[model samples]
Target: MDKIIKTSKTIRAILKVLFWVVAVVSVVILAAILVALFMKGGTALDGGFSITLGNYSLLLNQEYSSQQLTSLHFMTFANVALFGTLSCYIIRVLLNVFEPMSQGKPFSTTISVALKKLAYAILIMGIINLVLQIATNLIFYNVFDIPSLFNADRVESCSISIVSDGSFIIWFFILRLVGHIFKYGETLQQLSDETL
Candidate 1:
């Protein structure tokens, strides 16, 4: 048990560090996109725009039917950054819950409360991700003329994806159920401790 606890603590500490790095990087990237947009001002949407970071790149060169799409590429990056940061934060909260569990107190109120908070965060992020997925599909397929990875039809465009819409809702309910289970466990553990 001591070895397990030590290992758990070590892994959790590493994960916490990684999460902070990821969160910071996400925020920095988002800030960079915003700064670039502001620097360009009105001309930001007038012509082609592209930003490359390492191996990845965002390009908007095709003629768009609506002027609104001129900023869609930037919005896409911003959305990605927001999602990444939020995910890191969620994981960080989860790590907090684990810290107590790793110390041999698995059914405490702190764990239950953190689990509940994590569940709600997952649900909220799920809804936001669903909306973003639809927008992304539309933007990438229609505006950018990028083909779908799942679909073989190259020209056919679709805004909705079953995986994105279905999976998040399913996970939200699952996590909420787990959180309630943990709360029940915490109550039982408290009762046991009191009787002892």
Candidate 2:
């Protein structure tokens, strides 16, 4: 029990530090994007960062429709930055959940509530990421008119995958189960205390 408490405390400390780091980084990135947008006088699609994934040989050098501003690209960057912020929030919630455990109150209602919130946060983040990926892909396909061959093979192969991070959904269910267990434990503790 002492070891568990010590470990939880250590992990909570680490998570707190990581949460702040991610929060600061997310703010910085969003600020930089805004600054670039203002100075460049265009949307994120205009003179913004470009990234391409996959084999260069199979890919046709994917590019956006125009070098001017576009709402789609801006939304993509916003979504990514929002996702980072949400991730930090999730870490903060996890830290909260660990707090009672580190103090040797593992089955408290507070812990259960925090775990439920953490699970919901994970679910929300996963959904938002999926939506953003789908919107970005749709925008990319519509704006950038690639050849049929490249679109059929290379684009499909290189598109952002939705199944890669499906573990979050599983984790959500697990967290809910653990929360219910904690609630039950708390109830048992209450009954034992009353009898004593």
Model 1 agreement with the true structure over 1-196: per-residue lDDT tens digits? 6876787688788888889888887877777766665563244454465544359776756443334454575666758676886789788887888788689877767876787777778777877877777777666556554553225765464344535546666777787788788889988988998999
TM-score of 1: 0.68
TM-score of each: 0.68, 0.77
lDDT score for candidate 1 against the true structure: 0.70
Error of 1 at 44 (Å): 9.1
User: Largest lDDT belongs to which candidate?
Assistant: 2
Instruction: Indicate the TM-score of model 2.
Output: 0.77
Give the alpha-carbon lDDT of every model: 0.70, 0.74
**RMSD in angstroms, all models?**
6.5, 4.4
**Top TM-score model:** 2
Among all windows of 10 consecutive residues in model 2, the one with the lowest summed lDDT is: 42-51
Which residue pairs overlap in candidate 2's backbone?
43-69
Question: Which tens-of-lDDT digit does each residue in 1-196 have in candidate 2?
Answer: 9998999999999998998888888888877766655554333343333435454433334333334436554765678587887888889888888898899988777988888998898888888877877877766655554244354754555333445568879989999999899899999988988999
Candidate 1: lDDT of 186? 87
Clashes of each: 0, 1
